[model samples]
Target chain A: MTDTTEAFRLVVVSAGVSDPSSTRMLADRLTSRVVAAAKERGRETTVTVVDLRELLPELPTALSSQLLGPRFQRAVDALSEADGVIAAAPVYKAGASGLFTSFFQVLDNDLLIGRPVALAATAGTARHALVVDEEMRSLFAYLRALPVPTSLFASTEDWADDALNGRLDRAAHELVLLMESGFARAVRNESWKRYQHTFGSDAGRELGIDTDTDLMRLAAGGSLVDSEDPFDPRTA
Target chain B: MQFGIMSVSDITRDPVSGYTPSEAERIDAIVKIAKHAEEVGLDVFAIGEHHNPPFFSSSPTTLLAHIAAITERLILTTSTTLITTNDPVRLAEEYAMLQHLSKGRMDLMLGRGNTAPVYPWFGQDIRQGLHLALENYNLLHRLWREDVVDWEGKFRTSLQGFTSTPRPLDDVPPFVWHGSIRTPEIAEQAAYYGNGYFANNIFWPKEHYRRLIDYYRKRFEHYGHGTGKQAIVGLGGQAFIAKSSQEAHAQFRPYFDEAPVYGNGPAMEDFEEMTPLSVGSPQEVIDKTLTFREAFGDYQRQLFLMDHAGLPLKTVLEQLDLLGEHVVPVLRKELEAKRDPEAPANPPSHADLVKAKYGDDEPRQPRPNANRGDNVTGGSPYQDSEAEVSAYPTL
Candidate 1:
C-alpha cells in the first residue's frame, strides 16, 4: 500500500513580516529537513510555501465576511491538500502573530482534522519560546491535527547555538514518519464520518424518530422509509 | 418558475442621501414596496424575520397579512420564519390563521435564525440550535398535519392531544421551503421532508450553493420524493439594474461599498463575479440569472434581495420595474422552454396543494365539537366526521 513513487506534498506556512525575517528562515530549514528525511525513506517531496504577509490585506475581509478571495483561497487549498504541514510563526505580544492564527481560524474546522502538522515558532527571546507548546499546539489540537511531540522553538540566542538544528531534525523526522506510515490517511478514511453531522443522519434519526414518526414520514410526503433499503423495488 | 423579491427589512442611512427612514417610515415603505411587487407582475413577496434592532420585521405575520390584503396576486411568504426560537405551537396557529386571512395566498420558508443572542432571548441555547430546529419543525409539521398531536421531543415540553387552530386552510398546510445558506443538514432536512429547499444565494459564490442544491436533489430522490431534477429548489439572488450597465454600477456602487452585510469586504465587481449578485443592465441581469439554471439545474423559485443596504423604496421600485418588465418575463419564457416537461414548473401554491389533498371534494373546514372540556377524552374533537368536515368547503 505504500507508494514510494508518489510525491508527498509539504506546505510551509510562514508568518514572518519582514523579508529577512527569522520565522521564514526557520520554516525553510524545517521544510528542507523534512524533505531530506522523506527522500531517505525513498519518498519524493514537493514543497509549497505560503507567506502570510501577502494575504494580510485580505485577512480582515475574510475574518469579517467568512468569504475568502482567490489568493487566500489558493493558500487555504494548498494547506488542505498537503500530506503534512510545516507551520512557523513569529511570536508577538507573548503569543503567535495574529495573522498566523487568523489564517487557520477562517479555514473550515474539518479541513485539517487528523492531518499531521509540525509546529515551530520564532521569537525575540527565550521567554517567549513557550509560545510553541502553549499557543500553536493548542491551536492545532483544536483543529484536531496530529502535532508530533517534538515542537521546535527558535529564539535569537538559540540561533547561535546548535540545539535548534537537533530539535528541527527530530520534529522533521517525526512528521516524515507519520506521513510515510500513512496513519493520517488511514484515520481519515476510517473515521471521517465520525467527525461530520449529516442531515437525516442515523444519529439524528435515532433521536426518538422512526419511519412511523409523522414528521419523518410527512417529510418524505407519505413515502415508505427507504433509508434502510437503498435498493427498494419501488425506486429500483 | 416563481420570481419575486425578499427583503431583510434593514433600516440604514442611504449612502447617497445621508438619510435614514424612521421605523414608521421604513415599515410603510415596505408595505408599498410589496404592493408594487404585484403591480409590476411578480409572484411572491417574502420578508425576513428578525427580532433585533436595525431590522424591522420582528413580526412577519403582521406585515405579511397586511401585504396579503393589499396585493391580490402576489403570494405572501417569509424568506425565513425562525424555526429554532419560536414555539412550534404558536407557528402552527399563527401561520394557519394567516393562511385563513390570506385565503390561502401564503406559504413560509423555515430557518434556524442566524443571530446568536436571539437563541437565549427565546429561551433556547445556541449550542442546541440544530436539535431545536429539528425538533421544533418536527412538531410544527405534526401540528399542521394532525388534528391533535401527542408529542415528546428533546427541545420542547411534551404535548398531549394538543390541537392548533384555525386548522390549516382547506386542511392543507402552507407549502414549506427550508432555507439554508451552507448547511447540508438543512438541505437534507428539506429533502427528507419533501419540502422546498431555498438557497440564500447572496454573499457566497455559486459553487457553495451548487453542492448544497445537488445534495438536496440527490437526497430528495433518495427519499422517494421525485427525480433529482424534479426536487423543489429556490434560490435567492441580488441585482441592481438600470437602463445601462454603467449607470447600474454607478448608482449601486455607493450602496454596495458601504452596505452592512458584505460592505468593505469584497469589491462589488468581485462579488458580482463570485455570487449571484448582478449590477448591470436588464440583459446583464437576465444573463447572470440564466446561469443559475446551468449551475443548479431547473429550480422552482428565484427571489432577489432588492430592498436592503439603505437603498430607498423609490430605487428599489425602479429595480423591480427592470426585474418585472425586462428581466423576469424573458426568464420565465426562457426557463420554461428549458425545463423538463415532467418537472414541476411552479412551486405548490395554495390552490394546487388543496386540490392535491382533497381532489374534487370540498376541503376540510373544522367545526370544533362544542367546547369539549378535554380534547383528549373526546372521541373526535370536530362535530363532523373527518371526511365530512373535509367535504364541507366543496358543498
Candidate 2:
C-alpha cells in the first residue's frame, strides 16, 4: 500500500548549543512547517537531525592525514547523499563558530552544489539578524547551493514576542514550501527521466509478455511496468 | 595556506556610523566577515568561544555548523575547542557528526579555557585544568586514531573496548591545532604529537610570543617533527583596514573603545603598546603581520579578528572586501615568494579528506554489515566514541 513516489527526505542541521539557542527552536519550527506542508500536499516526509552540539565531541583524529580510517568515510557518504537540508546555528562573534567553520573545511565542494538549503540563526538581540542573508547565504552561494529566499532570524525579542513568533511560523511554512518545490523539481526532472529511460528501453522485451492481459498479469506479478506511460515521452 | 578569522565578541558602537550594535550584531558581523573571507579565496574561517557577559560565543561548533551549509571552499575551525572542561566523549561524537554533515571541511583548536567559573559549571576544578586537558586530549586522540579504544583516565570513566560510530570521511580525523596564549605545556603537547601549535598572538607583544614559539619549535624539532619551522604553527591577529590609514583609524576608534575586553581592561593599552592590532590601511596590517614571522618563524596558518567590537555588518563587509580584494592577494604573493621549497606544503586541507575517502580504490570494498553497525563510521575530523554512546548521558 506504500506509494512509490510519495516520500520526501528532509534533514534539519541544528548546531544545538545549549544556552540561549534560538537556532534549535527555529529549526524545529521550520521542520514543523515543512512536515505540515508536505502533509497538506499528500506527501510523506522523513526528517533527520544533525545535531552539531551532540555530534561535535566525538569527531575522530587525523582529519588531514592520508591514512583515513573507516568511520570518517561513512560520514562523507551520508552528506553527499542527503536530500533536503536545513542548517541552523547560534550567531557568534560576527561569523560561524570555529568549530562550525572547521567542520565545513573537511567537506568536498561538489557534494553541496545545487542542494536546496534553508539557513537560520539565533542571537541574543536583533542587531545582526541579516547575518544569515549576508554571511551564511553568501557561503552557500560559493558552494553553489540553491538556498531558499526566506531565512529565519530569531533574536531574544522574537522568541519572547507572540507577534514575532507568528512571523517565524510563516517564514518556516514558506521555507518548507520552497524545499518541497526543489525536491519535486529534482524528482520530476532527474528521477523521472531515469525511470523513463529504463522503461522505454526494455519494458516489453524484458517482461517477456506479448499480450495485454499477459502484460497486466506480469505487472500484477511485479515484473512489468505499471505507469500510464512507462516509456515517458516527456523525458525523451 | 588556510586563512581564517576569529572574533572575540564585544558589543560596541561603530566609530564612523556611531551605531552601537548588540551581541547579536557582533555575531552577524563575523558571519559576513567569514563569507567575505571565503569570497576572497581564503580557505578557512574560525571563531572563538567565551561564556561570560559581553562575550557571545559560548558555543563555537554550532555557529560553524550553520556556516558549513554556506561555503564550499572555506573550511570552518574553532579558535579554541575547550579541552579542560568539555568532556572528550561529547567532543568526539559531535565533531564526527558535523564532519558527516559538512562532508569534511572541519577542524578545531584544543585549548585549556581561560574562564575559571566554567570549570565548576561543568563539574570540574579550575586548578586541575591542565591535568584535565592532558588526560582528556590523550583519550580523545586515541578515540579518533584507533578503531576501538581501551582507554582509562583520572577524569572520566575508562573504556575497555569502545568504537566511536560515524567514523570520519576516509577514516581521517580532523587536523588539530593546539591554541595557547601562555601555556608552554600546550605547545609541548602540540609539538609532541606533531599537531599544529597555534600561538594566538592577539593580546601579547612579539617578544612575548617568541619564547612560546621558540619553545614549541625546539620541542617540535626534538620530537623529530622535522625542523622547527616545519613543526605545524598558526597565529591569530586583529585588524581594521580601509582605503586610507586615517579613515581606518577614525572609523575603528569608537568601536575599540566600546569593545568589552579592550573597553575597560588593560588589553587595549597593552595591544596598542606592544601587540599587533592594526587600525590602519591594509598595507599596515600586512607589515605588522609580516613582523610576526621574525618572532615566531614562518608559521603555517594565519587568522585575523576583524569583526569584533560590534562593528556594523556594512563595515565588516567592507573590511572583508578590502581583505580579499587587496590585503590577502598581496600577502599571498609576497608570502609565497618568500617560502622555502622545504616548507611543509600548506597543512593538509579539508578537501583532502574526501579525496582520501572516495579516491582510494583499495579500501572501497563494502564493510561487513554486522561490523558496520558496530563501527558506524563518519567523515568528520574528530573521533567517535567507543560506541554511539551518548556523551550527554544526562540528556
Candidate 3:
C-alpha cells in the first residue's frame, strides 16, 4: 500500500453516456488487467473512478466556463493533480467527442507532463477501430503524457464474445507490468515527475500570486523567498 | 506515419477468472493502455462514443481531455464522433477546447454509428443519419474555420452570428477524417473537402476497403486535394499474439471461441476468416498486416486492436511488450521505406500550421472585417454572393 501510494496513483476516467456501451466494457477490461497485474506483483493499489456522465449537463458548461472563464483556474485541477489516468471515450466523428475533449483544453500545461495514461475507445463495429491509435495516441504524445503501448478496441460483437473477457484479463495484466515498469524506471525521475502543476506567478494578479520574484522562483522550481508571512494573500 | 489506439468500454467477465471488471476498472484501463501506447512509440489514441447498453463511452471528448492530461506526442483522435447524433454547436465548442488543451494534437473521425437506438436518444431520426451527418459536419467545418457563423438547417436550430471559442488553436481547426465501412457517401464527403478518409478494415476482405479507398482517392484528386495517391488514408486491425503461433492461438482461441461476434453460429475461426482480426503469432500478425498496402494503397495510419479478448492485464502487457519491441519497429521501418515523397507525410498538424500562420506573433488578430466581400479572396461562396446565404435561413 505504501509503495503503491508513493509509487503512483491510478485513475480510470471514462465518459460513457450510455447505459451499456462498448467503451465502458473495454474500460472495465483494461482496469481489471492493470489491477490484476499489480496484485500479481504484490503491489497494493488504489483506484479512483470519475464518471463524466455524473458531471453531465453541467459538464459541458462547467468545462467550457472553467476553460474560458476568468476563474478557469479551478478547471482540471484534478487532472493536474493525478499521477496516472485512464481516459476512455466512445468514438464519435473521426475523433473524440467535443464534450470529452473540452475537459482537457482547460487543464494547466504541467498536469500531463510525463504522466502515464491508457487510451480506450468504443465503436459500433470493428471498422473505425483504428481511429483510437491513429488519432488519440498522437494527441497524448503532443501533451507529453506517457501512453501505454496496447490500446483496447471494442465493437458491438465484443459484448457477447466470451473471448473478449480473456482479452480484458490479458490487458489488465499487461497494464500492471507497464505501470510497474513506469514506476520503477521512471516514476521518481525529476524530469518526468518533479513538476505536477504550474502557476504563472507572473500572472500574479491573474493567478493571485503576489511577488513577481517569488513567482519566477517558484516557476523555476526554486524555493520562495523567506517572508514574515508567506501564506498571506497580500505580501510578507 | 500516423498511429493510434482505441477503447471500446465493455463491461464483461474476465475470460480466465470469470470476473467481470467494473465500469471503473474498464475506464482505468484506458489510462494505462494509452500510456503504454506512447511508451511503445504509437502515434494516436482515440475513444468512441455509443449511447446504448453495455457500451459505456457516451462522451468521448471528456475521456480525451483526461488522456490529454497524461500524454505527449500521441495524437488523440476519435474513431467515431457521431456527427449525425450530436449538435454542431456543442460539438464545436468541445473540440475547440480540446485543440487548446492538446496544443492542436487533436483531430477526429466523423461517422454515422451503426446503432439505430441512438437516434431517438439524441432526438434524431435514424433514416436521416446520413443527411444529418453531412449537414452538421458542414456547419462544424465552418464553425472551426470561420469566426462568426449565421445559419439555419433542417436538423438543428439556427445559429445567429455565433462564435465558438476559444477559437481553434492558431485559427487552425483539428483536421478531420471521415471514416466509413459501408457508406460511400462518407467517402465522397471526405474527398469533397480534401479531409482524410479512414476505412476501418476489421470486417470484410481487403477488396472492400480498396474500393472505398480508391473511390475517396479518386474524388480527392477530382476535388484537387492532390494526386489520387496523395489522398489521406487510415486502416484498422486486430491482433492476439504470443511467443509462438501455437501458444498464441492456444491461449486466444477460447476467447475468440466465446466472442459475442465470433461465438455461436459463425465461430471464432469463421469470424477471423471474414475480417482482419489476427489470432496468431507476432510475426504472423505483422506479416498479415503488411499485406494491407496491396489493397488500401499508401495509407497514413495503422491501428491495431489487442486488448479485447478479456485475457487479463498480464497477458495484455506482454502483448504490448511484443508490439513495442518487435512488431511496431518493424512496421515503422517498413512503412517509412514504402512512403512516396509526394505523399502527405502525416495528417496536417495544427501546431505546425498555427506557427506557420502566426509566427513570432500573438494569436492572429480577430478579423472582424476580414471576410467582407471587399476583402474576400474567393475562398468561400458566401464572400460575394448574398444568395449563397439564402441556402440557409438567417439566424
Candidates' RMSD to native:
6.5, 28.5, 28.5
Q: If both were scored by DockQ, which would come out higher, candidate 1 or candidate 2?
A: 1
Of the true interface contacts, the fraction found in model 2 is 0.00
Which digits, one per residue and each the tens of the lDDT, describe model 1 over residues B1-395? 99999999899999999999999999999999999999999999999999988999989999999889887889999988999899999999999999999999999999888789998898876765765676678788889988888886555677887888889998899999998866665776798888999989887656666777888888899889889988999999999999999999999999999999888777788778767889999999999999999988998999999999999989998888888999999999999999988789999999998888889999878788778576565444776644333322453
Q: Would you estimate the TM-scores of all the predictions?
A: 0.89, 0.56, 0.57
For model 3 the local lDDT of residue A129 reads 79
True contacts kept of each: 0.19, 0.00, 0.00
**How many collisions per candidate?**
3, 89, 162
Off by over 4 Å in 3: A1-236, B355-395
lDDT of 3 by residue, A1-236 (tens): 12444544577777778887556667776776676667677776567666666555444333422212222332244555455678888878667666566555545454566667888887787887797788888877766677777676677887788876776666566556556655423543435334443332111111222224432222222222243323322352
Compute the lDDT of residue B376 as modeled in candidate 2: 27
Q: After superposing candidate 1 on the true structure, give the runs of residues whose Cα lies further than 4 Å from its correct spot.
A: A196-236, B386-395
Please give, for residues B1-395, the per-residue lDDT of candidate 2 as tens digits: 55667766556566557776776766776676777778877777887777777677888777888888888878888878888888888888778777767777888888887688888888887776766776677777777766667665556776765766565555678888888765556666777777888877766435545666787788789878788868878888888888888887677777776575555333333345446677778888788777776667677788888777767777777777888787778877777777766676477665654465557553221132333333224322123322344233464
| lDDT (tens digit, per residue) of candidate 3 on B268-371 | 45445556777777788778778887667778888776666465766667777887787877877787788787777677777666775678677653433243
Query: How does model 3 score on DockQ?
Result: 0.01
Local error of candidate 1 at residue A92 (angstroms): 2.3
Roughly what TM-score does model 3 have, to 2 decimal places?
0.57
